[model samples]
Target: MCSIWRTLQRGTLRDIALVCLAVGVIGLSYGAVAVAGGLPLWVPVLLGLLVAAASSEFLFVGVIAAGGSPIAAVLAGLLVNARHLPFGLALPDVLGHGRRRILGTHLMNDETVVFALAQPDLPRKRAAYWLCGLGILACWPVGALLGGLAGTVIEDTDALGLDAMFPAVILALVLPALRDGETRSAALAGSALALATAPFLPVGLPVLLGLSGLVLAVGRKRETEVIR
Candidate 1:
Protein backbone atom coordinates (compact mmCIF):
# COMPACT_ATOMS: atom_id res chain seq x y z
CA MET A 1 0.00 0.00 0.00
CA CYS A 2 2.75 2.41 1.02
CA SER A 3 4.79 1.25 -1.91
CA ILE A 4 1.99 2.06 -4.32
CA TRP A 5 1.55 5.47 -2.78
CA ARG A 6 5.28 6.12 -3.04
CA THR A 7 5.24 4.98 -6.63
CA LEU A 8 2.45 7.38 -7.44
CA GLN A 9 4.28 10.22 -5.71
CA ARG A 10 7.37 9.89 -7.92
CA GLY A 11 6.16 12.66 -10.27
CA THR A 12 4.97 10.57 -13.23
CA LEU A 13 1.32 11.08 -12.39
CA ARG A 14 0.85 13.84 -14.96
CA ASP A 15 2.37 11.83 -17.78
CA ILE A 16 0.37 8.77 -16.90
CA ALA A 17 -2.77 10.83 -16.70
CA LEU A 18 -2.17 12.28 -20.13
CA VAL A 19 -1.59 8.83 -21.57
CA CYS A 20 -4.81 7.66 -19.95
CA LEU A 21 -6.66 10.50 -21.61
CA ALA A 22 -5.32 9.49 -25.01
CA VAL A 23 -6.18 5.85 -24.35
CA GLY A 24 -9.69 6.82 -23.30
CA VAL A 25 -10.22 8.70 -26.55
CA ILE A 26 -8.95 5.73 -28.52
CA GLY A 27 -11.21 3.43 -26.53
CA LEU A 28 -14.12 5.69 -27.39
CA SER A 29 -13.35 5.27 -31.07
CA TYR A 30 -13.11 1.51 -30.66
CA GLY A 31 -16.37 1.21 -28.77
CA ALA A 32 -18.20 3.40 -31.24
CA VAL A 33 -16.95 1.28 -34.13
CA ALA A 34 -17.87 -1.96 -32.44
CA VAL A 35 -21.37 -0.76 -31.69
CA ALA A 36 -21.78 0.63 -35.19
CA GLY A 37 -20.75 -2.77 -36.54
CA GLY A 38 -23.77 -4.28 -34.74
CA LEU A 39 -22.07 -5.65 -31.62
CA PRO A 40 -23.96 -5.34 -28.35
CA LEU A 41 -22.74 -2.40 -26.27
CA TRP A 42 -21.71 -4.80 -23.54
CA VAL A 43 -19.35 -6.59 -25.91
CA PRO A 44 -17.07 -3.58 -26.52
CA VAL A 45 -17.26 -2.56 -22.87
CA LEU A 46 -16.33 -6.07 -21.78
CA LEU A 47 -13.55 -6.36 -24.32
CA GLY A 48 -12.10 -3.00 -23.23
CA LEU A 49 -12.02 -4.16 -19.61
CA LEU A 50 -10.91 -7.72 -20.26
CA VAL A 51 -8.75 -7.71 -23.37
CA ALA A 52 -7.30 -4.24 -22.77
CA ALA A 53 -5.11 -4.65 -25.84
CA ALA A 54 -6.12 -1.91 -28.22
CA SER A 55 -4.75 -3.41 -31.43
CA SER A 56 -6.04 -6.90 -30.76
CA GLU A 57 -9.43 -5.65 -29.67
CA PHE A 58 -9.69 -3.55 -32.84
CA LEU A 59 -8.65 -6.50 -35.00
CA PHE A 60 -11.08 -8.83 -33.27
CA VAL A 61 -13.98 -6.43 -33.66
CA GLY A 62 -13.07 -5.81 -37.32
CA VAL A 63 -12.95 -9.54 -38.11
CA ILE A 64 -16.28 -10.11 -36.43
CA ALA A 65 -17.79 -7.20 -38.32
CA ALA A 66 -16.55 -8.66 -41.59
CA GLY A 67 -18.45 -11.91 -40.94
CA GLY A 68 -15.33 -13.92 -40.08
CA SER A 69 -15.68 -17.02 -37.94
CA PRO A 70 -15.11 -16.67 -34.20
CA ILE A 71 -12.23 -19.15 -34.30
CA ALA A 72 -10.52 -17.24 -37.08
CA ALA A 73 -11.00 -13.94 -35.30
CA VAL A 74 -9.52 -15.37 -32.12
CA LEU A 75 -6.55 -16.75 -34.01
CA ALA A 76 -5.95 -13.43 -35.79
CA GLY A 77 -6.13 -11.52 -32.54
CA LEU A 78 -3.65 -13.93 -30.95
CA LEU A 79 -1.28 -13.51 -33.84
CA VAL A 80 -1.47 -9.72 -33.59
CA ASN A 81 -0.75 -9.86 -29.87
CA ALA A 82 2.12 -12.32 -30.15
CA ARG A 83 4.50 -9.32 -30.14
CA HIS A 84 3.92 -9.20 -26.39
CA LEU A 85 5.88 -12.39 -25.90
CA PRO A 86 9.11 -10.45 -26.44
CA PHE A 87 7.85 -7.60 -24.24
CA GLY A 88 7.28 -10.03 -21.36
CA LEU A 89 10.70 -11.59 -21.76
CA ALA A 90 12.35 -8.18 -21.82
CA LEU A 91 10.78 -6.89 -18.59
CA PRO A 92 11.32 -9.58 -15.98
CA ASP A 93 12.34 -7.13 -13.27
CA VAL A 94 9.28 -4.92 -13.64
CA LEU A 95 6.95 -7.92 -13.50
CA GLY A 96 8.14 -8.99 -10.02
CA HIS A 97 6.52 -12.07 -8.36
CA GLY A 98 3.40 -13.73 -6.86
CA ARG A 99 -0.16 -12.32 -7.06
CA ARG A 100 0.83 -8.85 -8.21
CA ARG A 101 2.79 -10.42 -11.01
CA ILE A 102 -0.40 -11.74 -12.57
CA LEU A 103 -1.84 -8.25 -12.65
CA GLY A 104 1.50 -6.86 -13.79
CA THR A 105 1.66 -9.21 -16.74
CA HIS A 106 -1.90 -8.43 -17.69
CA LEU A 107 -1.04 -4.73 -17.71
CA MET A 108 1.96 -5.18 -20.00
CA ASN A 109 0.73 -3.17 -22.95
CA ASP A 110 2.83 -1.04 -25.36
CA GLU A 111 2.32 2.25 -23.54
CA THR A 112 3.20 0.82 -20.16
CA VAL A 113 6.26 -0.98 -21.45
CA VAL A 114 7.52 2.06 -23.31
CA PHE A 115 6.97 4.40 -20.37
CA ALA A 116 8.50 1.98 -17.87
CA LEU A 117 11.62 1.39 -19.92
CA ALA A 118 12.11 5.11 -20.50
CA GLN A 119 12.62 5.60 -16.77
CA PRO A 120 16.15 5.68 -15.39
CA ASP A 121 15.96 3.39 -12.35
CA LEU A 122 14.15 0.19 -11.38
CA PRO A 123 11.88 1.90 -8.87
CA ARG A 124 10.81 4.52 -11.37
CA LYS A 125 10.28 1.87 -14.01
CA ARG A 126 7.94 -0.14 -11.82
CA ALA A 127 6.17 3.03 -10.81
CA ALA A 128 5.66 4.14 -14.39
CA TYR A 129 4.40 0.70 -15.37
CA TRP A 130 1.80 0.47 -12.58
CA LEU A 131 0.61 4.06 -12.92
CA CYS A 132 0.15 3.87 -16.67
CA GLY A 133 -1.41 0.42 -16.47
CA LEU A 134 -3.97 1.30 -13.79
CA GLY A 135 -4.81 4.61 -15.42
CA ILE A 136 -5.44 2.98 -18.80
CA LEU A 137 -7.38 0.12 -17.23
CA ALA A 138 -9.78 2.56 -15.61
CA CYS A 139 -10.16 5.04 -18.45
CA TRP A 140 -10.41 2.54 -21.32
CA PRO A 141 -13.51 0.77 -20.05
CA VAL A 142 -15.28 3.94 -19.03
CA GLY A 143 -14.61 5.50 -22.42
CA ALA A 144 -15.83 2.36 -24.15
CA LEU A 145 -19.05 2.42 -22.14
CA LEU A 146 -19.70 6.03 -22.99
CA GLY A 147 -18.85 5.56 -26.65
CA GLY A 148 -21.04 2.49 -26.98
CA LEU A 149 -23.99 4.49 -25.69
CA ALA A 150 -23.13 7.40 -27.97
CA GLY A 151 -22.88 5.14 -31.01
CA THR A 152 -26.66 5.13 -31.29
CA VAL A 153 -26.66 8.87 -31.99
CA ILE A 154 -23.46 9.27 -34.01
CA GLU A 155 -23.58 7.29 -37.24
CA ASP A 156 -20.02 8.00 -38.42
CA THR A 157 -16.74 8.36 -36.48
CA ASP A 158 -14.59 8.65 -39.58
CA ALA A 159 -15.87 12.16 -40.19
CA LEU A 160 -14.47 13.03 -36.78
CA GLY A 161 -11.11 11.48 -37.82
CA LEU A 162 -11.08 9.02 -34.89
CA ASP A 163 -10.04 6.21 -37.19
CA ALA A 164 -6.75 7.94 -38.03
CA MET A 165 -5.81 8.53 -34.42
CA PHE A 166 -4.84 4.94 -33.64
CA PRO A 167 -2.12 4.64 -36.26
CA ALA A 168 -0.92 8.17 -35.54
CA VAL A 169 -0.49 7.30 -31.87
CA ILE A 170 1.33 4.08 -32.76
CA LEU A 171 3.70 5.87 -35.10
CA ALA A 172 4.47 8.41 -32.40
CA LEU A 173 5.34 5.63 -29.96
CA VAL A 174 7.55 3.87 -32.49
CA LEU A 175 9.38 6.98 -33.71
CA PRO A 176 11.42 7.35 -30.54
CA ALA A 177 12.72 3.80 -30.75
CA LEU A 178 14.15 4.55 -34.17
CA ARG A 179 16.89 6.68 -32.61
CA ASP A 180 18.70 3.44 -31.83
CA GLY A 181 20.47 1.97 -34.87
CA GLU A 182 19.52 -1.65 -34.33
CA THR A 183 15.93 -0.76 -33.60
CA ARG A 184 15.85 1.49 -36.66
CA SER A 185 17.18 -1.30 -38.84
CA ALA A 186 14.69 -3.76 -37.44
CA ALA A 187 11.80 -1.38 -37.76
CA LEU A 188 12.62 -0.42 -41.32
CA ALA A 189 13.05 -4.04 -42.34
CA GLY A 190 9.83 -5.07 -40.60
CA SER A 191 7.92 -2.17 -42.13
CA ALA A 192 9.19 -2.94 -45.59
CA LEU A 193 8.27 -6.59 -45.23
CA ALA A 194 4.83 -5.72 -43.89
CA LEU A 195 4.13 -3.26 -46.72
CA ALA A 196 5.37 -5.71 -49.31
CA THR A 197 3.19 -8.49 -47.93
CA ALA A 198 0.13 -6.34 -47.24
CA PRO A 199 -1.55 -6.98 -50.56
CA PHE A 200 -0.52 -10.63 -50.81
CA LEU A 201 -1.08 -11.88 -47.25
CA PRO A 202 -3.95 -11.84 -44.81
CA VAL A 203 -4.12 -9.00 -42.30
CA GLY A 204 -2.54 -10.65 -39.23
CA LEU A 205 -0.02 -12.80 -41.09
CA PRO A 206 1.94 -9.81 -42.43
CA VAL A 207 2.76 -8.72 -38.90
CA LEU A 208 4.02 -12.20 -38.10
CA LEU A 209 6.16 -12.10 -41.22
CA GLY A 210 7.53 -8.69 -40.19
CA LEU A 211 8.79 -10.26 -36.94
CA SER A 212 11.42 -12.04 -38.99
CA GLY A 213 13.23 -8.70 -39.30
CA LEU A 214 13.87 -8.74 -35.55
CA VAL A 215 15.20 -12.28 -35.78
CA LEU A 216 17.42 -11.44 -38.70
CA ALA A 217 18.78 -8.31 -37.00
CA VAL A 218 19.59 -10.23 -33.80
CA GLY A 219 21.25 -13.04 -35.72
CA ARG A 220 23.48 -10.59 -37.55
CA LYS A 221 24.50 -8.99 -34.26
CA ARG A 222 25.35 -12.40 -32.81
CA GLU A 223 27.44 -13.29 -35.86
CA THR A 224 29.33 -9.99 -35.58
CA GLU A 225 30.02 -10.66 -31.87
CA VAL A 226 31.30 -14.14 -32.69
CA ILE A 227 33.70 -12.72 -35.29
CA ARG A 228 34.98 -10.24 -32.68
Candidate 2:
Protein backbone atom coordinates (compact mmCIF):
# COMPACT_ATOMS: atom_id res chain seq x y z
CA MET A 1 0.00 0.00 0.00
CA CYS A 2 2.86 2.38 0.81
CA SER A 3 4.51 1.61 -2.50
CA ILE A 4 1.26 2.15 -4.32
CA TRP A 5 0.94 5.65 -2.86
CA ARG A 6 4.67 6.44 -2.98
CA THR A 7 4.07 9.14 -5.56
CA LEU A 8 2.25 11.38 -3.08
CA GLN A 9 4.23 13.86 -0.96
CA ARG A 10 3.77 13.97 2.81
CA GLY A 11 1.72 17.18 2.73
CA THR A 12 -0.41 15.91 -0.10
CA LEU A 13 -0.97 12.68 1.77
CA ARG A 14 -2.01 14.50 4.92
CA ASP A 15 -4.46 16.79 3.15
CA ILE A 16 -6.02 13.94 1.25
CA ALA A 17 -6.31 11.92 4.44
CA LEU A 18 -8.13 14.77 6.13
CA VAL A 19 -10.58 15.01 3.26
CA CYS A 20 -11.12 11.26 3.45
CA LEU A 21 -11.91 11.54 7.15
CA ALA A 22 -14.48 14.22 6.48
CA VAL A 23 -16.08 12.22 3.69
CA GLY A 24 -16.26 9.22 5.95
CA VAL A 25 -18.26 11.19 8.47
CA ILE A 26 -20.68 12.36 5.77
CA GLY A 27 -20.99 8.81 4.51
CA LEU A 28 -21.82 7.65 8.01
CA SER A 29 -24.62 10.17 8.20
CA TYR A 30 -25.92 9.07 4.81
CA GLY A 31 -25.99 5.42 5.81
CA ALA A 32 -27.68 6.08 9.10
CA VAL A 33 -30.31 8.29 7.51
CA ALA A 34 -31.08 5.89 4.70
CA VAL A 35 -31.39 2.82 6.90
CA ALA A 36 -33.44 4.67 9.47
CA GLY A 37 -35.75 5.82 6.68
CA GLY A 38 -36.52 2.15 5.97
CA LEU A 39 -34.00 1.45 3.22
CA PRO A 40 -32.10 -1.80 3.42
CA LEU A 41 -28.54 -1.64 4.75
CA TRP A 42 -27.25 -2.63 1.34
CA VAL A 43 -29.09 0.28 -0.26
CA PRO A 44 -27.05 3.04 1.29
CA VAL A 45 -23.82 1.01 1.11
CA LEU A 46 -24.38 0.21 -2.54
CA LEU A 47 -25.34 3.80 -3.30
CA GLY A 48 -22.22 5.04 -1.52
CA LEU A 49 -20.07 2.80 -3.71
CA LEU A 50 -21.96 3.34 -6.96
CA VAL A 51 -23.13 6.94 -6.83
CA ALA A 52 -20.00 8.27 -5.08
CA ALA A 53 -21.59 11.75 -5.06
CA ALA A 54 -22.73 12.56 -1.56
CA SER A 55 -24.99 15.50 -2.40
CA SER A 56 -26.65 13.63 -5.21
CA GLU A 57 -27.15 10.57 -3.05
CA PHE A 58 -28.70 12.69 -0.35
CA LEU A 59 -31.08 14.25 -2.86
CA PHE A 60 -32.02 10.85 -4.22
CA VAL A 61 -32.71 9.41 -0.79
CA GLY A 62 -34.66 12.47 0.27
CA VAL A 63 -36.82 12.40 -2.84
CA ILE A 64 -37.52 8.68 -2.70
CA ALA A 65 -38.30 8.61 0.99
CA ALA A 66 -40.70 11.45 0.47
CA GLY A 67 -42.75 9.32 -1.97
CA GLY A 68 -41.18 10.73 -5.12
CA SER A 69 -40.77 8.58 -8.20
CA PRO A 70 -37.54 6.68 -8.74
CA ILE A 71 -37.18 8.45 -12.08
CA ALA A 72 -37.47 11.78 -10.31
CA ALA A 73 -34.80 10.78 -7.82
CA VAL A 74 -32.50 9.66 -10.63
CA LEU A 75 -33.06 12.88 -12.57
CA ALA A 76 -32.20 14.93 -9.50
CA GLY A 77 -29.01 12.91 -9.06
CA LEU A 78 -28.10 13.48 -12.70
CA LEU A 79 -28.64 17.21 -12.44
CA VAL A 80 -26.39 17.41 -9.38
CA ASN A 81 -23.61 15.45 -11.05
CA ALA A 82 -23.73 17.43 -14.30
CA ARG A 83 -20.79 19.48 -13.02
CA HIS A 84 -18.61 16.48 -13.83
CA LEU A 85 -18.86 17.26 -17.52
CA PRO A 86 -16.62 20.24 -17.02
CA PHE A 87 -14.50 18.26 -14.60
CA GLY A 88 -13.81 15.57 -17.20
CA LEU A 89 -13.02 18.11 -19.87
CA ALA A 90 -10.39 19.78 -17.69
CA LEU A 91 -8.55 16.65 -16.51
CA PRO A 92 -8.21 14.34 -19.47
CA ASP A 93 -4.56 13.56 -18.80
CA VAL A 94 -5.06 12.45 -15.23
CA LEU A 95 -7.78 10.07 -16.39
CA GLY A 96 -5.24 7.96 -18.31
CA HIS A 97 -6.46 5.67 -21.13
CA GLY A 98 -8.82 2.70 -21.53
CA ARG A 99 -9.46 0.87 -18.23
CA ARG A 100 -7.67 3.43 -16.11
CA ARG A 101 -9.75 6.16 -17.70
CA ILE A 102 -12.92 4.33 -16.79
CA LEU A 103 -11.88 3.94 -13.18
CA GLY A 104 -10.61 7.52 -12.97
CA THR A 105 -13.91 8.86 -14.25
CA HIS A 106 -15.75 6.76 -11.70
CA LEU A 107 -13.59 8.25 -8.95
CA MET A 108 -13.82 11.78 -10.29
CA ASN A 109 -15.46 14.15 -7.81
CA ASP A 110 -15.03 17.79 -6.78
CA GLU A 111 -12.37 17.00 -4.15
CA THR A 112 -10.16 14.99 -6.53
CA VAL A 113 -10.46 17.68 -9.20
CA VAL A 114 -9.56 20.49 -6.82
CA PHE A 115 -6.53 18.60 -5.45
CA ALA A 116 -5.36 17.74 -8.96
CA LEU A 117 -5.63 21.38 -10.04
CA ALA A 118 -3.72 22.63 -6.98
CA GLN A 119 -0.61 20.66 -7.85
CA PRO A 120 2.26 22.42 -9.68
CA ASP A 121 2.96 19.65 -12.17
CA LEU A 122 1.08 17.02 -14.11
CA PRO A 123 2.77 14.14 -12.33
CA ARG A 124 1.94 15.61 -8.93
CA LYS A 125 -1.56 16.37 -10.13
CA ARG A 126 -2.14 12.77 -11.15
CA ALA A 127 -0.65 11.57 -7.89
CA ALA A 128 -2.87 13.83 -5.82
CA TYR A 129 -5.96 12.99 -7.86
CA TRP A 130 -5.57 9.24 -7.63
CA LEU A 131 -4.51 9.31 -3.99
CA CYS A 132 -7.44 11.42 -2.85
CA GLY A 133 -9.91 9.62 -5.08
CA LEU A 134 -8.79 6.21 -3.88
CA GLY A 135 -8.81 7.32 -0.27
CA ILE A 136 -12.40 8.58 -0.53
CA LEU A 137 -13.47 5.42 -2.35
CA ALA A 138 -12.25 3.31 0.52
CA CYS A 139 -13.45 5.51 3.35
CA TRP A 140 -17.00 6.19 2.14
CA PRO A 141 -18.17 2.58 2.01
CA VAL A 142 -16.53 1.57 5.27
CA GLY A 143 -18.18 4.42 7.08
CA ALA A 144 -21.51 3.64 5.47
CA LEU A 145 -21.29 0.02 6.59
CA LEU A 146 -20.65 1.00 10.20
CA GLY A 147 -23.40 3.60 10.16
CA GLY A 148 -25.84 1.15 8.63
CA LEU A 149 -25.14 -1.28 11.44
CA ALA A 150 -25.68 1.47 13.97
CA GLY A 151 -28.92 2.50 12.27
CA THR A 152 -30.27 -1.01 12.70
CA VAL A 153 -30.15 -0.59 16.50
CA ILE A 154 -31.58 2.89 16.61
CA GLU A 155 -35.38 2.97 16.94
CA ASP A 156 -35.98 6.67 16.30
CA THR A 157 -33.75 8.43 13.82
CA ASP A 158 -35.94 11.53 13.70
CA ALA A 159 -35.81 11.91 17.46
CA LEU A 160 -32.03 11.73 17.19
CA GLY A 161 -32.16 14.63 14.68
CA LEU A 162 -30.72 12.72 11.72
CA ASP A 163 -33.41 14.14 9.43
CA ALA A 164 -31.81 17.56 9.10
CA MET A 165 -28.32 16.27 8.40
CA PHE A 166 -28.64 15.64 4.66
CA PRO A 167 -29.28 19.23 3.62
CA ALA A 168 -26.93 20.53 6.29
CA VAL A 169 -24.04 18.48 4.96
CA ILE A 170 -24.88 19.42 1.39
CA LEU A 171 -24.88 23.09 2.33
CA ALA A 172 -21.58 22.69 4.14
CA LEU A 173 -20.01 21.13 1.07
CA VAL A 174 -21.11 23.98 -1.24
CA LEU A 175 -20.44 26.84 1.18
CA PRO A 176 -16.80 27.14 0.19
CA ALA A 177 -17.62 27.85 -3.46
CA LEU A 178 -20.14 30.53 -2.55
CA ARG A 179 -17.27 32.86 -1.64
CA ASP A 180 -17.07 33.74 -5.34
CA GLY A 181 -19.45 36.50 -6.36
CA GLU A 182 -20.67 34.88 -9.55
CA THR A 183 -21.17 31.52 -7.91
CA ARG A 184 -22.93 33.10 -4.97
CA SER A 185 -25.31 35.04 -7.14
CA ALA A 186 -26.13 31.96 -9.14
CA ALA A 187 -26.57 29.85 -6.04
CA LEU A 188 -28.88 32.31 -4.36
CA ALA A 189 -30.94 32.74 -7.47
CA GLY A 190 -31.12 29.03 -8.11
CA SER A 191 -32.00 28.26 -4.52
CA ALA A 192 -34.74 30.86 -4.42
CA LEU A 193 -36.21 29.58 -7.65
CA ALA A 194 -36.17 26.02 -6.34
CA LEU A 195 -37.88 26.92 -3.10
CA ALA A 196 -40.50 29.00 -4.83
CA THR A 197 -41.44 26.32 -7.31
CA ALA A 198 -41.17 23.46 -4.86
CA PRO A 199 -44.66 24.10 -3.60
CA PHE A 200 -46.32 23.50 -6.96
CA LEU A 201 -43.84 21.33 -8.88
CA PRO A 202 -42.91 17.70 -8.50
CA VAL A 203 -40.09 16.88 -6.12
CA GLY A 204 -37.28 16.66 -8.69
CA LEU A 205 -38.63 19.10 -11.26
CA PRO A 206 -38.05 22.09 -9.02
CA VAL A 207 -34.34 21.26 -8.97
CA LEU A 208 -34.28 21.40 -12.75
CA LEU A 209 -35.95 24.78 -12.69
CA GLY A 210 -33.39 25.90 -10.17
CA LEU A 211 -30.66 25.24 -12.73
CA SER A 212 -31.99 28.02 -14.90
CA GLY A 213 -29.99 30.46 -12.81
CA LEU A 214 -26.88 29.15 -14.55
CA VAL A 215 -27.78 31.23 -17.58
CA LEU A 216 -27.24 34.42 -15.60
CA ALA A 217 -23.94 33.09 -14.29
CA VAL A 218 -22.71 32.08 -17.71
CA GLY A 219 -23.63 35.42 -19.18
CA ARG A 220 -21.87 37.25 -16.36
CA LYS A 221 -18.75 35.16 -16.82
CA ARG A 222 -18.65 35.93 -20.51
CA GLU A 223 -19.05 39.64 -19.82
CA THR A 224 -16.16 39.56 -17.37
CA GLU A 225 -13.96 37.59 -19.72
CA VAL A 226 -14.57 40.08 -22.49
CA ILE A 227 -13.78 42.98 -20.16
CA ARG A 228 -10.51 41.33 -19.12
Best by TM-score: 1
lDDT of 2 by residue, 190-225 (tens): 889989997986555666676778787888889999
All candidates' lDDT scores? 0.83, 0.80
Q: List, residue by residue over 56-104, the lDDT tens digit for candidate 1.
A: 8889999999999989888888887887887898899998799999999
RMSD of each: 2.9, 5.0
Best by lDDT: 1
Candidate 1 least-lDDT 10 residues = 1-10
Clashing pairs in 1: none
